[model samples]
Target chain A: MNTSKTQKHRADLLVSCVHDRAPDLIPALEAEVKRRGLEGEVKVVEAGCRGFCSMGPVLLIQPDGTFYVNVQPADVPEMVEETLVKGRVVERMTYQEPSSHACALYEDISFYSKQHRIVLRNCGMLNPASVEEYIAVGGYEAVGKALFDMTPEGVIEEVKKAGLRGRGGAGFAAARKWETGRKAEGDIKYVLANGDEGDPNCFMDRALMEADPHSILEGMIIGAYAMDAHQGYIYIPYEHTLSVKTMRNAIESARAYGLIGEDILGSGFDFEVEVRVGAHSFVGGESTALMHAIEGTVSEPRPKHIHTTEVGLWGKPTCLNNVKTWNLVPEIIGKGAEWFASIGTEKSTGTQVFSLAGKINNVGLAEVPMGTTIRELIFDVGGGIPNGREFKAIQIGGPSGGAVPASLLDMPMDYETLEEAGSMMGTGGVVVLDDRSCVIDVARYFLDFLKDQSCGKCSSCREGIRYMLEMLTNITEGKGKMSDLEVLERMGKSVKISSMCGLGKSVPNPVLSTLRHFRDEYVAHIEDHKCPAGVCKALIEHYINDQCNGCGLCLRKCPQDAITGEKKELHTIDAEKCIQCGVCFDVCRFDAVGVR
Target chain B: MPKLKSLDELKKLREQLQGDIKARTDSSTTITVGMGTCGIAAGARETMHAILAELESRGMDTHVTTVGCIGMCSKEPLVDIQQGDEPRVTYGNVNTEMVPRMIEEHLVQGNMVDEWVVGRVEG
Candidate 1:
């Protein structure tokens, strides 16, 4: 009566999110598993980031999909007994929804359920360092498929069908670049993977580079195969040491497996790849500037009279792609182009990995389909703004990219839609802004950033951005004329049109978009000399209201001894001494601190 | 780490390694054999090897492991099978020859062998 035995699988206790906080659990889990005599039955895999950064040191038991958050070495024994050995979930270890107070599994969690991970598919599933594990999860098969199964033109056609675009915010068609490189007359063409991410809060590229490095290599190999290019360079900022290290390791592993070197998969295709570290700059992610850096020159953009796809990297046809774009290549090839195109919108196909930062409740990485509205990305996937504050704006794209106001929350996040809204999907970095965030101040922040980063190749970028920054600064300090707004818009537009590279072209997006959408906020500052958000120091004054119960917390926190009050009575802020620091506003439990 | 020569070779390797990483995926069935000295002396090691090879040939992905004896010396080589949310079924006096049918009836068919199964425990 006995039936056939099933192919035996191993149970893996994945110590997910193996970053700075993982060393303790990683070592303890391995040693404890061995000591408990469960090594054969259970495997301790140190996985990459699960994208839920705040709730990490997470543990996931595979074959059962039981996820435990905030696990520590001290809890390892009980976890090993109650979950690993006993074959059940430790209910207390699961993640609880902040509002609902309800516990849910990883798949059912709102944060994860809303996300459709394509680029991040392998990020937390396996040990990134192990090529065997990568292969086990269907890695590097794309190279075989690309080189053996499809011709170069066939591959390009497939990508065109997929409608893959540049994810570094430019939104250029990836297949168009590859086709140009393939058709261009060159014997020494190159494929470049741009990991030199420069957005203020964007780490999606770095995360992809660090977490699943083999995927990057796999994608690059496929790119090289498609473009008829042999040499490749992964240009990462020097500061991303972990990403650099993992990429190098992944390259070596792929090379050893003959996935990267000559005659890959026994086909006649010969390709090799290496890592290139450059001086970190916001402009470094731009295709032209990245090529200049790779050529051992100062990292600055060159005019695109002749495209890089035709002549680049020492006068050879070169194709450069963002790390996220390169990461998606393998997935597209492995799963057909039609499958990828089916996910996102018609024009913008495939999913985008958006790094949710700034004032959001869930400050993590989310890969959602392209057609997902900004509302879904911010509220459904990103868990909305923190502390029940009203959403004022979201700075999407990057420093050079524009901010969308709460009015456009329903705007679908595709290249065309975001661009039409005066924003670029700058590598999918979404910085949420609450009511407290000043649009003028936010624009000033980006202008200040661009002033330092712009290469000065175009006078419009150098002078235009500097003047834009000064005007925004003056406006924030309650010193703007109505005439200044017109000049600012004209200059922002000139910089957008005149700049040679991506840096200057899109540099003034923040100011222009804010002026376009939140013009009343600027008028509030210019005419009334008041910062509605109470941020500009020169325009606002702080005082304690009658609601103050004299907690004395603000008195202790005030650096200038501006606050003085009795322990049980309403406190007062000395107007002469108050520097408008707003420390009292942050510290007071009661709604006592008022800005006027 | 010799380079794979062709697509077929890579495909073969993928198919082979898929089994190795199955435990790392969403495989819910687990097969545990008693590997204590008494069990090993009763040819449990051979039975375990037979089960592994059989599973590979059958392309069935499940978790296979070994545990210490529970003092049932006479009923040596006790093999326990547990599927997802299913009660663990223990088969007594299991040998190499009994593995194929145990896999068929218990794992593939989802039924306990009437005469062979000695005990059961909560999943």
Candidate 2:
């Protein structure tokens, strides 16, 4: 055996090293160590993409849960000199504030104090690229326990007892699907990981897959074992590079370790995993359309006659769950049903991961126990709205989800509650809105996205979405009739009822939700022919206030030279030439710009 | 390839690990470098390397290891130090240049570097 290998094996420090997004720092740091003669004392390792994207570069100190932030190239010396040399700490750079002093712990930072990470537990802990690191942290031990210790029926019972419903918006009980798949009359059953997360501002599933690929793999393997499925496929988006690479490496590593492909853990069950990447069409995220795309056909949905559990993917008993749902399986099994059931609300066990973005002080991924109030997510975890802006509305669940007005901030964030609030918990993308955001414009943006993404297989989806888009466009453009509201509601219902897939079924969410919560915004646009938030260009005009010294910056920067004013005087916009471009508004730094 | 049949067998594995780690006990200084994915992405690798190198160069018996992210990615290259009942100090935005002084002043002399410590957590 190699002496270096022996030394490595003997190293007493249990280090799970991860550099959030900039993995290139590993080799460079390793080089710095060797150049300075600190080679054998430290072991350098590379890992996965931690889910926190907004904070770009971060590192976590373990065992005692010390966290540090905003680390740059220059601070390394002070860190090493103070902490490592004399066995004392350099308090200034710590993640946790000196308790007896003014600084705060990482948890006290309002951004993280409210989060309850479950699906994302290993994201920033273990190296995503290493199978061994995953194993050391009890990654595949669940598969071992499930395959040998428990019967398939026992596994299903445990999951049922755990109350782990699907996290991918549907909230279907995961164990029941397995039970149904197991009961279906078929020689071959299939397990599929639905990685088609095409929602706007939704990155939780992708982040989970990218950060902890093996956990997902282990979960899928366990699921396959429970359902007697021999093959699994991960239908990921073609554009998701990090998740694809991580998942592929994980699958290969599992195969090599005899954890997959043939008689895993010496149990007489075999499973193989495959990957299928799809294009940018949002319709492909729908189950039937995704299956059609997988079957070498154009992505389109078929009516639900034979359930996927009964016959799917070229006429076989198939079971498909989203990436987040698959990611939760190992945790449920490893921690035991009761422990898993202990988290979150009674109806919604465990935590739900959300991509917290838009106008918030902290924009990143957050995992809070289910039934966490939107107020807590936005105010406490998101650090409130940026620039002290008043909280306006929060659009939950992407384009097919509804908007929650500030009045409902105390509403719990779960499938049933959000649905009652006119929003489905579709993938947990909460885009926090500030007072500056126009509710009508926000609805319009989601409508535009849905309109372009509709597969056009059903007449209601195609025609209805197109009509809704036209009406919303007309409303925003100050050309809508009062009767347009009636048309929009009628078309939205037709699309919801006659749609072939979830994509079409939920397409009217933004419009319906906005109408429910902020019908005033739509009325303002239609009746007054004005945008309340002054966001829609056709309804608003921009002008520099008299406070402007006519710096000439605004005049010169105007696209069409709309500003007509002499130097050292307030500028006036020529309404004829203005085009309401708002260039003059943006260029004035003296708080002279006003949009009306 | 066999399941742990009895408690005795599990106990043996524990004993083997204990014997392997006998030399390292009562480590005076515990320095943890954040190596979570976000931390790693944020240049944690460099911070970790510099910390270890500085420790070895100063001949300090500090135990340097990697840990997971505490979910603050805005500040990467995190370092946590615990020494002799002194409050645990955390350093953020760590890089190579800060390592030597951190090792010399903080680890060796037990003098806290006020400029480098960004936070502290209670035991």
Candidate 3:
């Protein structure tokens, strides 16, 4: 189809009123539209995500592509009146730098400038529900190609040639798994899309599934063809109602178009997919556990001897890949393997999608080439650490993944570099921590999560992680002995070697890597009983500066009523009652509250 | 919708589809909302409805479309306007109130509203 005619029109305006968690703005904006009585003049439509989230609630006016930042309900009035009413740009509210004196567009922003998106190509572009829209943008063409043009073996060969690796954390070769399942001796080979994304603070898969369900469906259909599998399953958490509905709609749409179910595109292949809702068990994220859950068994994982590709899901050759991984297959086939391989590093091919979250200025989803440096992601793309706070450390992967200290901040992001930096690119949960973060406290938090998540299948993972958690807890509480560090290390090593699955094996990552890099902080906790970041409440003390105006604000705000002072006098914090909720620090107007 | 048989016949059908898509014309404004799961969860559906209702009330020709997540979830209920030289303008965190003024300002006039513009990429 010629896209030029469609492109010839005036630039379409794209805006995100849904972001910033302000849903009421939609009605307010609509009411403002009616109130203004300019009903037919400007076309205001809701588009999917615009991929630039840090500056939300963000506004993008098209043709000019002017990006507005920090938009609110109040700002909407002036924005509609001055710019929309008068046809003049809102100069002050637009994203402008104090030093450059130049307004920056979305592409001009450091956050979105450095990324390339192929798998996510249709995310912000097309109407997900419209088959025609998807078709217009060359969606399902790969499925068409696979069904009409390529053989099962040919499709698998093309995927292998693409060098596509799983984005679902295991970086396993996508083609190799397909080949294994294809060759496996079973009439009931299953292709399962594990959308049961349980990694804390990671929502990339759920976002993709919800945003572009068809892409995942297309990929799964193509995978089924390649693997010669007739049945497929999409496993997502029951809480993901949006994803479930979207996936169901996409499946229905595919079925309606004859893209799925029996004799697809006259290829004489019969395949269909079922969307399975998983219970919210952290262990259900595990492959074995997921398979068990699908089988209506307990959501706990069992010891894995045989690979699932050979024997899985009722003793069938079952292939389980993450949502993001399967979403890329059709693209690889359509664009060719060489095109896919050319984008990312040689070893870890294809772009990886990440949820660039936490304490960072650009908290959005990012898809950079596999080898994009962490410096680029954190500083260039993420707009560096927020609040002028110094960059301390970044936690990659989830709780099971380790944190990369400042020393390795420059390391390129891929499977290997993260592994070398004592972190794993597990499911692409990149959390940037600023200077205010206490390393010990962060370690303790991760350990707490791991302790809760660990499936008790292995004694080393269950009891050993419990022990490490206790030690880390002791250190964070300022009651740890100097020898506790060595004991924690010894225990962490044993857990790493003796654990069952990835969750168990890598549970020691936070404790071990923190001890490896930030041992001095641990020593400070043990020897001096000091939290350098002033985050550890047990070791830190709260005080009121002499600058306090004796305003009762802190005293009132303090849940414990820790502060006591007379008018115009310095305030004091009663240590016994102070709960360290940091409310006083937040409420104090005179900078009187001090944490040390 | 007959189940297509034979890969070659499917190929021919695909070619026919190519022609059909190219020859189509609506001239109606296509409002593609970034209602990806994140957007809807963020409330793009209501934003979409507000725009659709605005166009419908005025009896103006408009086609409201929904797309997947654009990765920038922080700014959602994202709206993309495609009407006539100008690229698509994306408004983040949109609602019913901004619709009338947006229609008056940008839809009728050829001018772009900078305040409602979230992030515009030339590429």
Summed backbone clashes in each candidate are 17, 80, 80
DockQ of each candidate's interface versus the true one? 0.26, 0.05, 0.07
lDDT of 3 by residue, A1-596 (tens): 33122222223344453643566655666677668764543444444565656666666654345567766667777777654443345777776542235463666765566778776766655445555556555677788788777899999999888888888787888889889889998777899999988878887887787667888888898998888789999998999887798789888877876778888866688889989987876668888899988998888877778989998898789999998888898888788888988987888988988888888877888888898888888877777776567898988888878889888877888898888878899899977887778988887888787778777889999998778878888888989999998888888888898888888888888888888889999999999999888888888887888888887888777878777888777788898888888888878777778888
lDDT of 1 by residue, A15-104 (tens): 766567756888888887788776765778777778887678887766556778888888888877656554445678888775675553
Tell me the spans in candidate 1 whose CA falls farther than 4 Å from its real position.
Answer: A1-10, B27-59, B63-103, B110-123
The digit string of per-residue lDDT tens for model 2 on A322-372 reads: 888888888887789999889887878888888888988767898899899
lDDT of each: 0.84, 0.74, 0.75
TM-score of each model, paired residue for residue: 0.89, 0.80, 0.80
Interface C-alpha RMSD, model 1: 7.4
Which 10 consecutive residues of model 2 chain A have the lowest summed lDDT? A1-10
lDDT of 1 by residue, B17-87 (tens): 67556765656777877766788789886787788777877778777766656679799888989898888
Candidate 3 Cα misplacement greater than 4 A, ranges: A1-4, A7-20, A24-44, A51-59, A68-87, A91-104, A546-556, A566-569, A588-592, B1-123
**Candidate 2 at residue A93, lDDT?**
57
Sliding window of 10 residues with minimal summed lDDT for model 3 chain A = A2-11
